[model samples]
Target: MLLDHFDYEKLLVPLNLFYDLHTGGPRRPIFHDVAATRPELLELDRNFSAIREEVLNVLPERASIPRYHELDAMQTYISGTVDKDRDWKVFPLNLMGVKPKGFADRCPRTVAILDTIPGLFEAFFSILEGGKSIPAHEGPYRGYLRYHLGLVVPEENPPSIRLKDQVYTWKEGESILFDDSWDHEVYNSCTQDRVILIVDIRRPMPQPFDAVNRAAQAIMKPIYGGQIARKLATMTPPATDGDAPAMAEEKQTDDKEKASEELAKKLPDQADPVQEWGQREATGKAPATAGHSAHGDKKPDAPE
Candidate 1:
């Protein structure tokens, strides 16, 4: 994720040019000194180590069990098959509703940077050892992008990853943010363990409204449909009491009906029957009818 907001158009030219140059040719090395682009990579390494320690200390032992697996026929038959190696697995910590204690104080700067990027509410530092490789797979959600910040890079054997056709390696303290919607995979061929701070962030798209709408739909799908609609509707300012014309009209009709009833009781039994009928019709109490009553002479009571 970008720490500073920049003109994407201006940045895209260089990015596309670099991508084209690196990906087009017969696999050429695109490894640049991570220090060249970002000087703060060193600080990230220190912070990452501190946070990792905190996470390991704070998280329950049961939560630390590695969930990723290759394949199990019995488990797949019961719970459905999951490509353990292909999928990116991590224990998410520090979400809005599920923020852990001491998280904000321990990693304030890192969290602040991540907060700027949308859809990124949590993070995880993954431990990948020798011969561990994540197979090629796309992200489940389309709106968000993923980021990898390398903390510990093995000197002898470092982890390598390929995005689209361009292969790249991780450098200690350096970070790579990319759209996980694109096909990507990782390989750790080295003898030592490779540790990286894996961050997932909302994709920076041209149309933010569409992206937000889609995110909302995904989040609300599990709950009742009507309940979600009502929640979204509440986001809009409610109708003002002063602007309720319907209520005012109903009140006026009630007042008129009360006045008519009072007047009818005071008058003679058969006085102005047609006028009373007309008033009732006007108030929506009776249907319209072609009838007239003058001087108390009834026209067959106008069919009641």
Candidate 2:
């Protein structure tokens, strides 16, 4: 039934320049009511206290746990210590449809609980230290909804997330599901650390498209296993507000310039525009002026 409802067109249409030219906003739907749509997530939400207790027990020794992006400068925004802090650490169970034995062993309970959720693609514990501010960026795709269950939120002014204009604050045991493909940013303004169980859940889609998305994820399992996500996250430039227009315009201009250059290379070196125009005119087949062109105004021909 879920597969029958999946709209592949929504996923495909966003890539169209025409769609972007007309609608500059995100093409993906955002902030759907998770409780109504995914009751399984609410069941998982009930386990927050248990998960948080486990996290607290492990916190003392989590100092050795590597930061999510140890080699990335972006971690500086999360921990200030680009080379040192392990603040934005992650404990991943499943990644891009691939389950790591060690990770599953480490978080057996969480892994067991998540295994029952057909919607889940990747499951992990996300740690954010105080004062962290993740800049605005969209996910690589809109194939999944990011689910966050607040495990341990700081008491002092909790950090808030801004998904476009809507701002949300996490409370322990509460959960939110959002389309990460939309431009979003996070700020942990609290004095203490914040911890959330982050789940990348494959968005429910129509039959064929759902199958296609699942197959695609299956194919990408090796990449996740190989830590390609880490490599890509560090390598790709961060997307921010206003970047869409600038990047699109630059790309369009570059494409036009390249096309013009290619066309010039194919044209005769000795060709003259004036001579060509004169030759066409002599043949009574002159090209129409800009205003009279097919794309412009269609003028009625003279009476025979």
Candidate 3:
């Protein structure tokens, strides 16, 4: 049921403004007719399943309790059970971190389609069967839209999600793109398991360049995290050594002070009784005696 006629020109203006105001936009039922792509999605599911296995093996042990009820009422089956574990969650589009090996190269079709727009393409696999739900949550920022392409939808009972006013039933091969910044939740009511491939893309914004910048940040943030990404965003490359004469002069001054300090250490010390007593007091050494001291001369060492 993939949509063939996506009138980019007609939607561009609203989309752009949506991006400007919300920092992202939502398109209702973008893949209303996406069931036609089921074959491709099935293949993707198989590929992702293998990847999921490998990812789970590589991940560290889970510590936190799984939040199952967040998705929907059916989540109880998958939630709270130690047996149920989510392994190898991969966020599509190098968003916020290093892009996993083979992810970009292997999923070329998905990447190509997503590249045409601005966003990420992610895949998730759940090991638990039946009644798993993702808790209600919003997207990180308002600059992008999210899409879910159902790859492995249980046959006995299907998973469904509510996005704002709409109720979405999982249809293998169908894609649903929506404004994830809005409240949303999903539930797998079926007796079987479910799998989905998700993507987060930059919605059309007033300034295309700004969108691009945000997208790059979104991609890098996963790898670098929020703090580092913000720092990187604000960072300006250092100017070449030749660019600032003032900086050069400051460095020279620092060097001269360092040299003078070194020379002073090598020279013989001048002594004063009062100063020597002050030095001893400062150093926490016994106060210099009124008598001749170790300095060999009668005068005391000078204060530092």
lDDT by residue for model 3 over 133-237, one digit each (tens)?
A: 566654444445555655456666687877666677865544554566566676655666565566554444456655554655544344334332233234332
TM-scores for all candidates?
Answer: 0.44, 0.62, 0.43
Candidate 1, residues 94-186, lDDT tens digits: the string is: 342233332333445555555554455346556565565776764434433455666556767688887766677876545665555456677
lDDT of each: 0.45, 0.60, 0.42
| Winner by TM-score | 2
Error of 2 at 50 (Å): 1.7
Measured by lDDT, the strongest candidate is 2
Candidate 1 collision pairs: none
Query: Candidate 3: where is the Cα deviation over 4 Å?
Result: 1-93, 102-129, 208-304
TM-score of 1: 0.44
Clashing pairs in 2: 3-206, 3-207, 4-207, 6-205, 6-206
lDDT of 2 by residue, 1-304 (tens): 3333333335444433332332234554568667655667765666655566556544544554546665323334544443243267766567765564434455556777888888577887777877666777766556677888777777679988888777888766667777777788887666678888898887766665567667756654554444534443343222322454576578766765665566566775846534444344222332212221111121122111
Candidate 2 or 3, higher lDDT?
2
How big is the positional error of residue 229 in model 1, measured in Å on the Cα after superposition?
Answer: 24
Rank list by TM-score: 2, 1, 3
What ranges in model 2 sit over 4 Å off?
Answer: 1-27, 71-86, 228-304
